[model samples]
Target: GGIITQTPKFLIGQEGQKLTLKCQQNFNHDTMYWYRQDSGKGLRLIYYSITENDLQKGDLSEGYDASREKKSSFSLTVTSAQKNEMAVFLCASSIMGFNYAEQFFGPGTRLTVL
Candidate 1:
């Protein structure tokens, strides 16, 4: 019984600033993912990692950077934030090798760019 943790429940950023969000899981899941949720849209994948130091770009990977520092931690950085941008960044983890794996989500980090 492990838990997922995300840092900084809320974030305020300036336009064009570089911001970073972090996620950590004690579940020892094989796969971790980062997703962006806008005001009304569906969750869009930003990045995923299957193993330590393995990074894969997702649909919204541009203008962002992701790193899987170790099996228990992952980080996402907004290379350049857009003005007036607002979104919630979510981090999830799952056991990819299992057929009935369930993804566990973090509380999410809300970003507001001025």
Candidate 2:
């Protein structure tokens, strides 16, 4: 069995400020991802790393940056927090292979911008 842990259950930031969130997993999966979930909107991919030191931009990567420092950890930084925008950031991991895989999510990190 494996477990994923996300730091900072909640994040409070000012508009235009950069904020960061971190995620770690013990499963040793090959792929890790960061996703944003807004109110009434489905999850949108922010960034994903296929392997250590490899970064892949996602649909919402414009305002974010991600890093895979090692096989078991992935981190994300918000380039700038948008005014009046709030969302939950979720971290996920899956095995790398030809078959379909389900992503396991972290509890989530809620962000509130002032």
Q: Which number leads on lDDT?
A: 1
lDDT of 1 by residue, 1-114 (tens): 999999889999999999999999999898999999998898999999999999999999999999998999999999999999999999999988365778899999999999
| lDDT (10s digit) by residue, model 2, range 57-77 | 999999898889899999999
TM per model? 0.95, 0.95
lDDT of 1 at 6: 95
Clashing pairs in 1: none
Instruction: Score candidate 2 by TM-score against the native.
Output: 0.95
Superposed Cα RMSD, model 1: 1.3
- What's every prediction's RMSD, in angstroms? 1.3, 1.1
Candidate 2 stretches with Cα past 4 Å from truth are 97-99
Clashes of each: 0, 0
